[model samples]
Target: MSSRQRRNDSAPQYLDATTLTAWRNVRDAGEVVVSRISAEMENQSGLSLDWYGILLHIYEGGEDGRLPQRELERHLYLSQSGISRMVSKMQEAGLLRREPSPHDRRNVYVVLTDLGRDVFLRATPVHHAAVQRHFGSWLSDDEIASIGRGLQKVLTAEGGSEIQCGEELDRLVTFGQSVLALTSDTVAVSDAILVRDALEPLLLADAARHVTPSAVQDMRAIVARMSTLIDSPEEFFRSDWELHRLLAGYCHNELLRSMYLTLLGTLSSRLDSVVPTTNLTPYLYERLSVHARLVEAVSSGDEDQVAEAAHAHHFTMARTRLVDAPGE
Candidate 1:
């Protein structure tokens, strides 16, 4: 059977509560990584991690390290359709140019443009900080070392090689479970609302009081904090909630804050494959100001101001996102 067919066939396997719960934690952790990174990338150079990955790959894999799309699909573990869409979007964005292979007309190679190279260079530091904050900050020195070995073992095992797992391996698994279990708080809603209210006024005032430049800086600081705690799932989720609540506070309309919070609460509900990978790019970063401005207006406590700011902010963010590379 084809891979897709096999996946479809496996869909109905009975999910025991333990396995289902484990799957949920895994999905939640991955979502935190994606959402936190995407938010930071959007605020930083405006590139999504997927888009950034595409550029990073092409940049590193020029003539010396050139790769075919098929190979890229394997390395990135993206489906054929996913790879195609990413390449197409990057091409349209003028970050890459595709050419038919000299040996096979049907084959194509993606090349990074000069502009794209410049973008990657400019974006690299931001990417580094984002990755460091999201994945780096959470691990202690010992956990970090263990994780490295564990990951190496996984890769080698996948390649038909075996690696010994020490006692710490079990400890890692146990620790991970404990972390996820902590986030299953029944009281999160009331807790979140309380926290949301405490911070909203200042955030709203800050957003309203600042112009675009200051607003972007303020938003980036918040996203940085949000992205830094990925190790402990409970802490990660709490930080994620705090960031959103702050946004709601900045927007200042309790109703609007609540509306956006409700939407964000669904992040952990869906399966991994259900959500499309995002293409973060520079223009997207500039557009985050919309959210900031809206929150600021909401903080001002005027319905007219809230409506006007939210409308303008959301529209601009949506419109610029339309300019994303076509296939992506």
Candidate 2:
């Protein structure tokens, strides 16, 4: 039999064993929960899961809340025109507006509005329920904490990049050459799918924001959900990537997904001067705190507070990182 057939045949035999079976059940249960929550979110809030994610980012960015399309593209791994189109659509919907960036004429800023905020405020509860119904119900405090530590260990072993564009990438490459410095444990080729899964929605939402805040938020929610997969890097990456690609495929724009994968692939392979040394346990603790805060903010309908806390939480992961490269 071929390698593919061999792997598949081996998978069932192994998966049937007790340890692997339990692990598979946990993963499958989470997936079911998410599906139920997504459906509920759609029915009650009239917002898809992806839009919820974008709203969180905007909420995090705060009042006077805005980010340049290019910046969004870089931070979120979105393409140029993709973000532009998204902005236009959202502007028409009155959820977000576009203005020329003061710092650069070539750049455009995407800003949320009162209407957008109101929608987010109302949807918070429904979304929270979905989260609880899914992952929260299955996980205890200690188990969740353990998962966080495990994920952090993986991140340390697989340090990622700042995820910039062509121009920024060139600048960093040149700087590294000049300093004779490079990050150890740079993102490797094998991790491309994970990186791609991380970037896809951020880019699409950046583009969609121009069209509709709800759509942009939906994309963001998808990004957030994808990011939560610290379960099995290899399996989760493969499973999630296929799922999103399949969903994006329905739009008849394979390029949307393909481009995201390509960008992530590049990011997975690129290196800067420093490798991540973040401890998984501490990082997870921080993330758990953030999740608790998110639960509270969503319940209270305090979008601004939620946004601020989320940004702060993501930043703390750097505390455990190795400031200098691994070998030196």
Candidate 3:
């Protein structure tokens, strides 16, 4: 049989009615909830959901009520042009203004105007009521918790992680150099695997030696933050990278921690180049699970378990690059 035929033959033939019904119910319910809330938001506050989200993010960002332009882009899940256009409209409406960063001239900051703040404050209650009425009221406490856990698991499986473009690009360049040295020439699957084998042990060792209860709590918080970003791939990867960086910072041995960070910086950068654009959802999910497993292992403080988890994590990553290399 052809490879495609074999793949088709291997696919499941059927789904049970219960499973189908459950899936349909969830999808339909999501549509209903969003429609109801969005309609209410527009009618009551004269604001689109997008406007509310942008204003809310800015309002909660800090006491100054400012968000970096790039940071706002991540939150809004909009392209630069899209955000710029929206911001322009809002600016004309006298809701917000863009200010150039004092420290970095290239960067622009989005500051909520007094009018924007007033709108946000006024709309908050209406938004909350709509959500509670359309969505929250339907679920009991246990059901809500169960749904949260289930969704988190799905995100973890999808490798939803975050890393800033600028930082990721720098790491990629550094990593490409490291891979060149390790392989003495072209980068290959085995070379990537070898690099992982060499570095993960050091990271696991550091964690075992220095990761504290407080650090574990912080790691969990990062993971929780990551769970929320599954729908935002760019933001997810940036956050995922932040979680690893935070773990590295927890290591008591400064030299070892720095070395591990350098190695990881390179690996992540290299991987970014090779990762396929299509069919990435599954790959991301698996990546998320690996990170979640590593966090749990670290918290357990079992050297053997940590080592095993690290091995699996690095192995899966290396394998992903090998399997998903462009044209492969």
Candidate 4:
């Protein structure tokens, strides 16, 4: 028999039991829970999940409550025609407006209106309850982290975001240089602080101001994991990266996501740097407290408090990092 035919003949025997079960579970869980959550959210708020998602993306887009029309379309996974129709309806309802960018007349921006904000805020609790009841509540924090980590691996293997533009890819390559030259413990604390001090608070504020209900659940899960890992500093910090990544996702800015992930990647090249000296036990406890507070701030939708907590969680600080090379 041809090799292809031979493999096909043996396919049944070669099927790993774990693989079979995992695939089925992933498929079933995603479809069933999403369907139920959609039904519940629509019933309670009269806003379909897709409608809420549009308002959500715009809400999370930035402090200005706007996103470029093309970028918004790319993120929403809708066809050009579908987005046009939805935007028209949302505009009719006073939920959104498509305004030409003053900076660039050719580009239209999707701006969330005050009515959209009210509707989104009103529907948020319903969405959260449904997500928790149907999805997040069923999983332990550790399970949630593990599942997130595994799926992220799959996403990475699959070339991650289809929407990653050339510029984003080019910048991501720069993060790789630090990977080659530095490990976790050797990363300069001052350099990490520079990135964290500036960008981290903004990301946290965005998360607090506009995170989707599903993203909130993920943040809580990571915080729960961090709470349990107060003694295990390395594990705790890895979980911290997960929480920050969740925070960054809600910002709805791909370029910003890249920048934050670069900071996180450089700091967490391995893990040990996050918890250096055993004598720093007090500092570790304090970090856990700050993380818990950050989550609370996010969950409560308190933007200022979220920014404050995130700033308080700043990593170790030292002196300025010298440039080792050009364009670094």
What is the lDDT of every predicted structure here? 0.52, 0.47, 0.64, 0.65
Best candidate according to TM-score:
4
Which parts of model 3 are misplaced by more than 4 Å? 1-25, 153-328
lDDT of 3 by residue, 165-201 (tens): 2222122211211211121222233344456457666
lDDT at 305, model 3:
83
Cα RMSD to native, each candidate? Answer: 15.8, 25.9, 21.5, 20.4
lDDT of 1 by residue, 1-328 (tens): 8654465468666556875675686578769977888788766556778887777666555573245676567667789899998888777787777777888776687777765665565455455556667876787989778766755755775763343432211111011011111123312432333344444444454445433545445655665554454333344445545555555444545665565566446333221211101232222333345444554564455656755664553321221222244454
TM-score of 1: 0.42
Better of 2 and 4 by TM-score: 4
lDDT string, candidate 2, 44-146, tens digits:
6566555555554565544466766665565445677776766566566566677888889987777877655545544554565467557766789998778
Model 4 lDDT per residue over 1-328, tens place = 8654575567355655776899899999999998999888766567777887887777665458888877667777678888988888888777788888888887788888766665665455456557768988799999987988888777766655432222211111111101111233322432553676578777777657778788777888888888788677667767877888778778766777788878777666643333133224665567778888888888888767776776666533321121111122
Instruction: Tell me model 3's lDDT, rounded to 2 decimals.
Output: 0.64
User: What TM-score fits each model?
Assistant: 0.42, 0.38, 0.41, 0.43
Higher TM-score: candidate 1 or 2? 1
Question: What lDDT does candidate 4 reach at residue 109?
Answer: 88
Which is the winner by lDDT between candidate 2 and candidate 4?
4
lDDT of 2: 0.47
lDDT of 3 at 46: 73
Model 4 ranges with Cα > 4 A deviation: 1-17, 103-106, 159-328
